[model samples]
Target chain A: MLEFIDANCRLGRGPAPREGAPNTTEEILALMDRFQVRSAVVYHASAQYAEIMASNRRLKEETRGSDRFFMQWAVLPPVWDLFPDPEALLDEMKQNGVNSVRMFPAQFGHSMKRYAAGALLDTLAAHRVPVFLPFDQIGNWDALYELCETYPDVRFVLCSPGYRCLRWLVPIMDRCPNLYVETSNFLMHNGFRLFCANMGADRLVFGSGMPEASLAAAASQLLLSDISQTEKEQIAGGNILRLLSEVAL
Target chain B: MIGENVLRGEPFKGVFIFDIHAHIDATSDFELTDSSPDKVVRTLDALGIGGACVSSILSIHADCPLGNLHVKEACSKYPGRLYGYLTVSPYDPDTDLDGAFADPHFKGMKVHAAFHRTAINDPRYEPYWEYADKKRLPVLFHAWELADVRHIAELAPRYPDAKFIIGHGAMRTWEIKREVVKAVKHNGNIFADTTVSVAYDGAIEWAASQLGADRVCYGSDIPFYDCRHVVGKVATSRLSDADKEKILGENAKKILDLP
Candidate 1:
């Protein structure tokens, strides 16, 4: 068995309640232990549906003592003056131990094209900090294509893309070297192997989408995939580790 | 990194795994990665699955009559390894259910209400349900919503002899899953399969805790989904080894009367 570093997990509560127990930090840690996940790159679920800064503060507070957890912050449009200066926000992120940032433009009611995301994307690109976007929130491949074209230096990770999105996702991988996708709900047959063949194993990251999604299923997908052991290790934890290492912050 | 070995090695090595929901032809109009029965059997062999109850995508998506022929062919090609499910659309008036069911290869019937553009409760399905009930055949519905579960709720009591295996465990929401658990609780003949439903965390455990292990069966939804990932969901779940045994093969064997 290989070590897993889940790239798409959440802490705190979302607006819509889930069926099982609340997604608390203690619960997630237990889940990580059960699934043999050594570490995780996590975002606060409240950030997806509630106030961004408050959620970020809560995430930092909850994960303060644990070295096993890597924090990912949520970003709103700069027009709201959420963070007055983009550079200052990066500095704040560094101080707070934030390794990556995520965007929920559609949920937060904003656009992520070069026009709306220009400043934030530029700053993150300069810092080499990765940006995580859900496939549904990214609108369409054209929007992603434009963003990838505009900020070629920025590492854009598409979170939990489904099997149907493969046709377009393949082309996006072909067009953008900086673009990557996380494996959580990626249930396509021979998907991991095919993705590694096309984009290289380095571009595919492991994600469990804990609480809401199965860690065992996600880990097994990469583990049992036709890809080589080295490829499995890269997808399991090495890829995300490399992405986090590249972050100047 | 050192538990059950979900990677490389056979995860269900000693376990008798029986995949209840699988397809022989293309699953969707868009793409069918490995539709050949030989490929399906090979994939199953690699993952340590003893057998699979397969339907033809041609029957579900295109022509049921033609697809059922492919089902027969797959069963003949791999005698004990592959069991057939006669795929039928209520809209296809020419569908000879009796003729298809007459084949010993076919163990049951598969209906996809979403693709057929008909509700399961529609009068058109009455004949199929009635026939299936009389034959004591297991009917696997593409049940992904509460209404689909409602369809099972409506028909299960009426045709008590027919085994109703809700496909995908009504996968869309927790509400639907609650209904599925409720339906299985109320009806002894009602069951759920672990197809696309495995994506949800604790789904199998939740289902087992709520409906008992015997009411749930392992289904790969292969070609559309993967066997390794689907089986891993059950293998790695919090359910007891005994309960896991029931879901993986024992329950299916009892339902399908497999040796």
Candidate 2:
């Protein structure tokens, strides 16, 4: 089986964790072992429900001494000095070994538009840090297209596009080279083969959407897909590995 | 035991695998990349699935006559490999399923109340429900909520001979799933499929323990979604091999009478 580095995962129990959802590091590690995930990039759910800074600090503390887990901080737009200074934040991330960041614009009640997130986006682009954006938070494809086009240097991984987003995804992907898609719920039939054929395997990354979803569903798409072994390897963990490595910060 | 094959990323061998909820062609909402019957069968062969019970996307969405024609022709082309679901339209309540049922390949009825804009228990669906009861057939519903489960619970007692399957049974929220368990527990004829894009961790295990292994069936919603991952979800669950065997194929095989 191909090794997987789950690019989308969440740590810590949310305000309303679903039944059978794993919250602790021990539980997640067991799931990882069973599902053939070598490692994972995760964010703290408390960052969504509580203060982002404190939750991110808790995430770093909780995941300390675990090489198998990589931390991804939840960031917000710098409105009313809501977040730390961009340079200072990047420096902290670099020191703490946090390479990627996720944004929850809808949940945080902020706009990812130029006026709100332009400064943060520019800083992220300068450092070459990849941003994980949920599909629902961006509202629609047009906003996503604009965000990608505006920050041509930054890498964006669109998560939870679902099985029905293919018609909308193809054109957007064609226009935005900086945009990539996670494989958690992109479950269109024969979609992996078709995507690799059209978009190249480099643009796709494997993500389990674990806890909320399972790892086997996304992992099996690459494992049983008609794509070549090398392509499968790229999608399973190679692509995300390359993205994280490109983070200059 | 079957999980060993799935864990090693190999096609399941020495066991029968059949998907009860699947579609043959593309829907209006999105393209299915390859929804042709040949491709569908090819996928089943690749995954070592013995067969799949499919309804045409066209049949449920629009054009029932033409859609049923597509299903009939596909079943003819691949005799035992593909089975047909005689999809009935709510608008055409007077539609005759007798002609469709004449062929042995036509196994059951598939109802999509969401698409047809009619409640499952509406007066128009009573005739079809009666028909399924008379034939002792399994009726698969495109149900994803508590209300749908409630409707099935109410109807299952009235139509004792007919089997009721709730498609996308693990959808939406955990509360809905708990309610689904409560409803299925009350109705012996009611069963649910482990088919949802959001295949949550331990969902298969939870469903098996709550609903009993026999009351749940394996369904992939194939072409709309792939079977491999959902198969992986069931195969790699914490449930015993016997329970996994039941969910992966045995339960569905018993329901469809496939040997």
Candidate 3:
């Protein structure tokens, strides 16, 4: 059996709860056990719907004792101390064992351009900390391209690009070497095979998009893809592990 | 266990697997490297599925006539391994659904009223619905909302013979899913297809609990979503082995009247 480290998961009690999704740590652990997942990198749903910093704190508290959960913080620009300065934020993240960060530029109504978010982007790039961005929140392919191109050193993992993104995704991926794609909702037919053929297996990472998505569904894509076993291994967990290990913060 | 086979990346040994919703040929929207009949069959082979009912992307998005021809060719090439869903354009009055269904390989009909910018219960669709009713064929509709579910409920009794499979399970929202369940609960002919790209955890189990396993059939929306992905979801669901078997293939088999 292949071990899995779910790279994209949202953990928190959101306003509207769906049937069968785990919001509590115990439930999540049980689900992980059921799916044969070794661990997961999770950000709280409150980060998307409520106070960002408090949600990060809540996430830290929720996952504090478990080695199975890796914390990912939701961040914003440090304008008027809306968020901590980049250096201080990174320091706090290092202290809390938060290795990766997530940004919601479109949702938060902030520009991802250099003028608005340059300090934070520069700091993340300098530390080589992996950044997780939902593809829908990136606004458009051109915006994603600009964000990635402007900060080439910052590793951007695009989550849930969807099946229809290939027409736009390919060209951006061709230009942005720093861009990686999460495989949970990247559901195009023969997507894994085509992506590997075009971008190599290293650029793809396994993500369950759990709580709202099926863990088994995400795993089976790579498991049943017409690719070499080594390639499958890389996507199932290897690529994510490599990216996380490279996060100096 | 069925899930064990999926976890081991092996095909189901004893269970029959049939996909009720699938597509052939590439869509103009995205890149599908090998969506041809050969590739779809190879994918089914990888997952140990016996067959799939497919509609051409061309039929839904562009030229319906040319797309139906594509389906005919694919069904002919693969025989029992592939089944055709004859798609007709509501805008084009000259749709020869009767001629299209002359081929024995064409098992059902597919309608994307949502894509065609027409209501599923619109008068234009009535002729096709009547044709499907007369033949007692399974009509798969691209249903994604509460209105579509309501339309299916309204039309189901009138066309008592035609089996109505609500494509994507009316999956736009959880509330919509509830609406679909309520609307289709009393109708024997109306069924739900588990074809959404986002497969919500426990959604299938919940559906089976409410609608019964027989009312829910496995529809991968394949070539749009991988067959293995949806198959693994059903296999690993919290549903009973019998329920999983039914949803994965048994239910689809009964609906499509496949052997």
Candidate 4:
């Protein structure tokens, strides 16, 4: 059996009503076991809608003793006074052992453009921390294109981009090497093969969107793809592991 | 156990997979990784799908007659591996649709209201539905929203004999999918296909629970979507082994009347 390190996952209850039972850390661990996931990069589901600091603390508390889980913090606009400053935020993240950051600009009532996220992006870029954002909620591709072009240092991993959005993503990826796409909803037919052929497999990372999406459904795409086993291993966990390991903290 | 085997690329030691929805021929609008009949067959083989009910993209997106000819030829070439779904265009003038149905390769009908720019409950489709009911043929519709479910609700009881399979399981929103489950529950002839859905956690299991495993059929929406992902969705769903077997192939075989 192939060992998996799921790049995208959440713990705790989400803001919206979800089918099935409530999602607790235990439930997530059980699900990980069921799907043969050895480790996962996790964030609190409440972080998408709740106070970022409180949610981050909640995530820390829940995952305190677990070695199988890594934390990704939800960040807010610096103007909100949620934290001291971008530098302090990075310091706090480093102290908390957070290797990555996730931004829910739309849910948090802000734009992801340079005007709103400039300082945060600069800090993250300098720190070499990867940030996860949902492509659909980012308003438009042009904004992402501009961000990638402007910030050549920070690694941006767009999460849950639909297969239809490839036309826009392909050009952005071609133009920007720092940009990456998560594999949870990137369901184009032979998308992994074509992506690896055109852009290189290093630009793609494995993400299950587990507890909200099917782990089997998300991972099966790469497993059954016509790509080589080495490439599959990279997209499955290698690329994200490399990104996390390189985080300057 | 079968799900594990499917993930590991071992032979699926369960019911044979019958993809109820798939497309063939060249697609001009969007890129298809594999569009030819041979490629489609290879994909099915790779994913352990025993057979597929396929329609021509040309028929759905362009000319029905030309597409039907291609479909017939592909089915003829593959025989039992490929079953034809006669694509009916509301725009094109009727062209021996009944005669086309007489072909042994053609087993069902496929209609895309969104592609044809026609309403599902339009009077023109009445004759087609009538024919399907008479022949006990299944009709697959590309349903995506609540209104599509409403249209199915209106037409399904009217043509009770024809098995109406809702394509994509009305996969726009969770609320709409819930309505689809309810629609299938109330209407006996209405069925849902597990293809290219939103992959919401427990969506397949919820559908199976509400409508029973026999009402949900496996569909890959192949060439546009990956068959492995679709199969994994059903195989890993929180349903019983018997239910998973029924959804993966048994139900599709019964719906398409395949041996």
Candidate 5:
């Protein structure tokens, strides 16, 4: 079976609940390589003050001579506030061939504002790119599902749905076709089985939230799982490829 | 907590668990960071640990004071499960013949010296050896690397009068450090438990090749680790079932003087 497309991977946490070892771009890629992962739509930690730009710049720098890797949406509070026009950054990202966005509510502690964060959403909607919302492990489903339903066109990537309330994730995604999940944290036991049963392999991807976990171990959760080979391939890499291809990132 | 590798994925009578350590205080607040005597039991049960060797809470070396009483209560109440050990602070006298010391519920003494800043070889603690020597109650020490083989070598010679166990098996680096064997030099009165890293039968084999098989005993440093995982490792080790049986069930019984 395909190991799984770990859609939810991270880099640059110097220390726990913070950024350290697996926090650097190189460390993260090495982690991904351990499990033989091909590419990831990247996001920077909340430290860089618009770390999304840092994430974008790094992806560009790393992929300058390569084609497999790409960038997602990452933004720091400062750089976002200083933007002359939000659309300009969006256009610049598009021109630079960036693909998606990653949202961090736990770090910022609230939903992206409609007017302040709203304009950015408008730009993404205009471009039809996806936004990955990582609630720092304690996600706000109400806000995320609302974003997915409201935007309809924006693809929202949710990482680490976790194990506590299994039903909580599946039902939320029911109303939002654009919402997807990344299997990164606590992927063992029953959650992987539940995801394939409900979210379907097409909507699921692999991720290791590494340094705290092993890519081979996490990927093995899916690779070793009893899912169909075709579905496994799609979850492993095809889905992300499809999503990235649509956005031209 | 224990799972039989012989029965892995085949599914049987449910997970047969034996938690080798715990301190429950169920009345205390329930949080993952710390433990209370009652909460310890519930946590063990919650984690599918069928049985445990619980220590008391609140004492000088102070480990857990009431965990044994609680485990006795649990054992009487639950049956075929739960083992309790009383706290005996080397800082405070073991009070061997006292009601708490002689209480039938407890099988042994959970003596923690390092955490409470007492020496394993201190003469002040000799009362415990004297008492254990008389009654044959095995004493479990909070041993790490404080005493090298030379020190254990010294202590074992002096404490030939009592039954003793080095807690955490010298923090399981017995092979890496050889602190356990270097100390005992085949002193039959002293035994170590595999509660941490190096307790594997691999260590047992190396020890046997050098010191022989009877030196080490198996213990699941439960609550601190996934007991099922640890037991699975032990039960499925390359060691023979006789060795497995000793580590899994018999050695502990012999050490604690359990009927």
Candidate 6:
């Protein structure tokens, strides 16, 4: 039985169109241990799913002492009046061991295409890091990828990119090798087959998107997958280790 | 007994225990477990369940159309053992809808508006309200707090002909308290479920008082919440055994119009 890496996680927030009962951190970890989770990229949730920086704040508070946790990605202000200089924010994220930031434009209500490209392009240029975005919204992704190629300095980390999204993105993976895909939203059987067949397991990384996703459910997918153990290890934890270590302090 | 505490399932003395609100997702990314329908049935059978009512993973997306369809097909194979609530997002564009809700196999309907990004009174979904009324079927809607209470209030009275089950009645946070008070005041067709996993102290008691035991139902919120956990807590609450029995099974049977 191999331990898993959860690329996406949300906590400290409450309900949505549907809400789960409130769960404390200790309650969450007990569920994780049932699945044998080795690492995770934790985020925070409140009324606004990704509107606030609560995930970042919670990451510092919860995982301050534990090395088993890593702050993968966080939602931040769109380089606006709240945050004028994104470099400082990037610096702050880097200090907290967050190399990437996950963003949701549709749910967040501000299309990244509208304001994020320039600020994030500049920030990534200055900090030389990746800006993680939801996988389905293609407009932002195409815009971000165009910027990444143009800048050649910044990287784009796409989280929860579904199997269909990956298939749609096959044409550009070679062009932007700097792009990394976290397999959180994709299921074990379907996502496993798609990533193994089309994207190749090397570009594929394992992430359960825990808390919101359980380590057990995520781990079970790999356990049930027909793929080799080598591919499983890389997707489960090894790939994340390599990707984040480059940006790790 | 199952609801008496965690890790404590109701003792089986040749009597079957059925949890109507139980749900399971095999490959769901959220903290959901993968007890596939096969595994789910087996687990339940092992726990001395004659049958269990279930839902699916499509709540996170509009996939409810396919998810429910798949679940119904899966339910057909189980027939007597696994009953299902045809999951619907009020805003699901693909709801072949009539065929789905009217399907002979599905026990009833479930509405997760929060996932669908619509409020209960959103006129775009009047079609569902009309259909549910026509079928004389009860629909379970996830109501987390006061905002939902207001939303439910508007819809419940308007559909005086419809039977509505209010989920999470105990932990009315935000405006849930205000919303629920207004709802119960205006609508007599409203029933609440004691599945508010956590709101604060006395939330469950308050919800039971406000909604009335007859108006409250038992739900485990299977995938995100837990069946065993809810069973233990509610069954052991300060309520009378009659109240506990009503919440644990009787209420759901009545709301769902179970045979």
- Candidate 2 per-residue C-alpha lDDT over B1-259 given as tens digits, one digit per residue, 9 for 90 to 100: 6777766667878887788898897777777768999999999998888899999999999888789889999999999899989898778865778877999998998998878887888878898889999999999999876787778888998998899998888545677787788878888888899888556777887788888999888899988887777877787778898998898789888777775
> Cα lDDT for residue B71, model 6?
79
lDDT per residue for candidate 1 within A1-249, as digits (tens), equals: 678899998887765555553267887788788777899998888878777877887887777578889999998668766554688788888888998989988888887766777888888888999999888887888888887888899899998787667767778888899898888878776777667776788888899877677787887777777778899889899999999998896
Candidate 5, residues A1-249, lDDT tens digits: the string is 243345655444433331222445665666455445677655444332344455556656653444545655564223435543656667777777767776665665544656446766766767768777654623566666666766776677787664333445667778778878776643323344446775677787666555443353355445534456777678778887788778743
Best by lDDT: 3
Deviation in Å, model 4, residue A62 alpha carbon: 3.5
TM-score, ranked from best to worst: 2, 3, 1, 4, 5, 6
Q: What overall lDDT goes with each candidate model?
A: 0.82, 0.85, 0.85, 0.81, 0.55, 0.59
For candidate 2, list the clashing residue pairs, or say none.
none
Measured against the native two-chain assembly using Cα atoms, what DockQ does each of the candidate structures obtain, in the order listed?
Answer: 0.51, 0.70, 0.70, 0.50, 0.05, 0.03
Top-scoring candidate (TM-score): 2
Name model 4 segments beyond 4 Å from true: A80-83, B11-14, B26-29, B170-172
* Model 3, C-alpha of B209: deviation from truth (Å): 0.8
TM-score of chain A of each: 0.95, 0.96, 0.97, 0.94, 0.80, 0.78
Q: After superposing candidate 2, which stretches have Cα over 4 Å from the reference?
A: none
TM-scores, all candidates, are: 0.95, 0.97, 0.97, 0.94, 0.51, 0.49
Model 1 residue B208 distance off true place after TM-score fit, in angstroms: 0.7
What is the per-residue lDDT of model 3 for residues A1-249, given as tens digits with 9 covering 90 to 100? 777889998888877777765657778788889877898999988988899998888887777578998889999888897789999999999998899999998898898989989999999999988899998898888899988889999999999998888888889989999999998898888888888887899989899998788787888776767788888888988988998998887
Q: Which of 1 and 5 is ahead in DockQ?
A: 1
Candidate 2 per-residue C-alpha lDDT over A28-90 given as tens digits, one digit per residue, 9 for 90 to 100: 888888878899999988886898998998887666568888889999877566678789899
- Ranked by DockQ, the better of candidates 3 and 5 is 3
Q: Model 2, chain A: how large is the TM-score? A: 0.96
| lDDT for position A103 in model 5 | 60
Candidates in order, interface RMSD in Å? 2.4, 1.5, 1.5, 2.5, 10.6, 11.0
Candidate 6 lDDT by residue in tens digits, B1-259: 3233221222223333456655556443333343467766654554344566777766435577667766786678888777777776655655776777565657666777777787766677787777777776676777775667777777776777677777776555536755665677678877776554433323444566666776666665554443433444454445776776676667666666556
Model 5, C-alpha of B41: deviation from truth (Å): 22
Better of 4 and 5 by DockQ: 4
- What lDDT score goes with residue B229 in model 4? 83
